[model samples]
Target: MADNIYVVGHKSPDTDSVTSAITYANLKNQLGMKDVVPAAAGEINNETKYVLEYFKIAPPVVLNDATDKKVILVDHNEVGQAVDNIMKADILEIIDHHKIGDIQTGKPIFFHNEPVGATGTIIASMYELNGVAISKEMAGLMMAAILSDTVLFKSPTCTDKDKATVEKLSKICGEDPQKFGMEMLKAKSDIKSKTAKDILFGDFKKFDFSGVKAGVGQIEVMDLADLAPKREEILAEMRKALESEKLDMIVLMLTDVIKEASDLLFVGTAAAKEGFEKAFGGKVTNNSIYKEKVLSRKKQVIPPLESAFKK
Candidate 1:
């Protein structure tokens, strides 16, 4: 195996996932691991692009397959959400902030898992713990990741640690967290030229709900008005994905960050409909549900759906 280690995050790369990979790899390199590098599992989204541009940091190279490579995972632990062909790779370490999913290694490795909001929060703290002074660029990236994942501290998943990390990072980067965060969100929300498919899969994930295969995507915007016109078009794309992917259910969460709510759009089999109802008690109208205060998919959406499908 190559001695070079690629630090990467989950597919459908969010700001937290992408930034954590870069920040963590920098930390590893600073600690004398010269071969450590950062990589992204998929295309960088607009919000992340804004962050990278603001910090004058380049995006990591995209790594589609991890076969025969050494890797340290960030942001996510689930095999289904990992880079392609990851099972054939040599796992080194995992740093995540979500409930652990199935990703096993032949040997024990450095696995850091916390319930904090963003993986960046953990990576930022690791800089302090390792006695490395965070650079301005790294601080900006970390702050953006925390703000993106926490929806500027409005998400239910946002922890005190995440808030503290962002507060510290903001000072180091000399950017007001709220002001920069809103600008970043505006970048994400501007989907004027994006295809319906692009908007749907820009931040999507796949899951096994019991025996059912489900796909869920989320797009966070400052105003839901931006999506109001394209709702039908997006729903049509969702239906297409449902059949083309052979998924039992496909869901899209059009989240409004300012309002802290989501409009859940889905297309699925009858069984999937039943499970959806079981997950969130509401009548699905026009194949959509308006959920107030539903922001974090990792925290709010997936858990109940997983349980609902199992029953």
Candidate 2:
């Protein structure tokens, strides 16, 4: 293993990805590992930016590619979501909460895959396991990541461990979980200033299953009705994305945090529509489907779509 390592998260980085990478890197350094620097596979999202600025921590260096570098991945294991040139890098470790994708390595590596809501929760337990004290800033960042990934503990992906970790972390950070979580979510609610491309790709992920090239993007808002006016514009942009990316299917999930529901917009082949209808059991009118209690894309969206594709 190389002495100098880069800790990174997946593309279109979210709060959990950013914080988990930094926190894990810090933990490694505290345990006598050196030069385990944190990096981001893509641009940080608004919520992550808010958390980093609130804690007065600088964002990680942007790493577009990892050719011939030693790296540790957090928050994602999918090759499509990974840093460019990941196949050429020496992957030493992986700590992630999402589904494992088609990632391969030439040598054996340390892997920690958990079912927790956020990668930060797993990293928090690692701090205890390693006997490293969590600093106030680290606590705050981890808290932000947990709250963001779990949607204030409202998403179906949230586990008891996530809630417990956030309660303890909120105390260390000296912030009320509910109040601070709302503030953090509000920071990402404003989308008027973002371009169509930005809105679509802000939290996008691509998946390949059984020869199906699918992309799913999500944006959380306080109110789904607030986005009604821009529906056509957004769908048009999604269509353009599908064509440009050469995807078999593309889905954009407009999530209402308060309502705990998601309105899905899709554009793709006829088989894609059939697959969605079979999996979701609803008519996709005007290229959209309003699904109640559909929040976690990993749990609710991808699994069903994968099942549908197999048929």
Candidate 3:
């Protein structure tokens, strides 16, 4: 059960999702926004783990409530993850740097779901807007998240706004963005002690789209070479994940930062296949994307489905 006002990130969280939730929850509590708690639906990847360890922070509490009420959702706007518990509370506010989804919030509420590089960037802006002092730890988390999500600003998903926000936050954090980028990606890449199941479902969720069921997961890596190498492992695990969650369809987004295009992995039901095909005119071959682009569930994946589902 969540506290008075819980703070949760999106399913399959990235550095921005996890770190921003923690930092934002910390700030809200400091400002007397009582009963604030930071939680994540996914496990911390190696890169995010390093950032937390560097700041001596722990992972946010694990939460998988698909119907969250009166909570703040960071990094993602998919209805499945955000709505679990939405009726119980009210979805009071949303602060994200992702493309908007079917957000269910009370009227006259504050929502900041931008197409920026990182939720941390949006959080940074909030601190600046509210004249809240940015702690060094919070600044560091935001800086790292910005670098990771933007591919050091080489990502097609990045906008000039993302750079400006990161630059300002970096100055506050005293981190060299370029240096940190290399280090962070390297940390995320060398995954030696993890199982394929742990690796895949470590940060996973089941999405019930009214009647159509779908699942989405986020994977961040510095190199694309490992993707083909890990292809078989990913496929088998995704099949298991679909069965375990009992989802009608599951889409595994193998987003390679280096390659850009996400290798979209599809499993189960014809409806999802047709739904995704109508959204993106990409040829499907055992759930793989030929042209690799920066695959962001927030920016690319969820938006199309939102439009398609309405039809």
Better of 2 and 3 by lDDT: 2
- Report lDDT (Cα) of residue 99, candidate 3: 52
Weakest lDDT window of 10 consecutive positions for candidate 3: 80-89
Model 1 over residues 1-311: C-alpha lDDT tens digits?
Answer: 26789999999999999999999999999999989999999999988998898898999999999999999999999998999999999999999999879899999899999999999999998999999999999999999999999999999999999999999999999999999998998898888978899899999998998889999999988889999889889999998999898899988999998888999998999989989987999878899888999998999999989889884
The superposed Cα distance between candidate 3 and the true structure at residue 185, in angstroms, equals 1.7
Best by lDDT: 1
Candidate 1 ranges with C-alpha deviation above 4 Å = none
Candidate 2, superposed: residue stretches over 4 Å from native: 1-3
> Distance (Å) between predicted and true CA of 161, model 2?
0.5
Q: How close is candidate 1 to the true structure, as a TM-score?
A: 0.98
Q: In model 3, how large is the Cα lDDT of residue 92?
A: 64
- How accurate locally, in lDDT, is each candidate? 0.92, 0.91, 0.73
- lDDT for each residue of candidate 3 in 141-180, tens digit (9 for 90 to 100): 9888888887788776788888998788788878888888
Q: Model 2: per-residue lDDT, tens digit, 1-311? A: 34569999999898999999999999999999878999998889888899999999999998888899999999999989999999998999999998877888888899999999999999999999988999999999999999999999999999999999999898899999899999999988787777778788989999986788999999999998878878888889998988899998899999999999999898989988889887798988988898999999999999999898894
Candidate 1 RMSD to the correct structure: 1.1
TM-score per candidate: 0.98, 0.97, 0.83
State the displacement of the C-alpha of residue 87, model 3, in Å, after optimal TM-score superposition: 2.7
Using TM-score as the measure, what is the rank order of every candidate, best first? 1, 2, 3
Q: What is the C-alpha RMSD of each candidate to the true structure, in Å?
A: 1.1, 1.5, 3.2
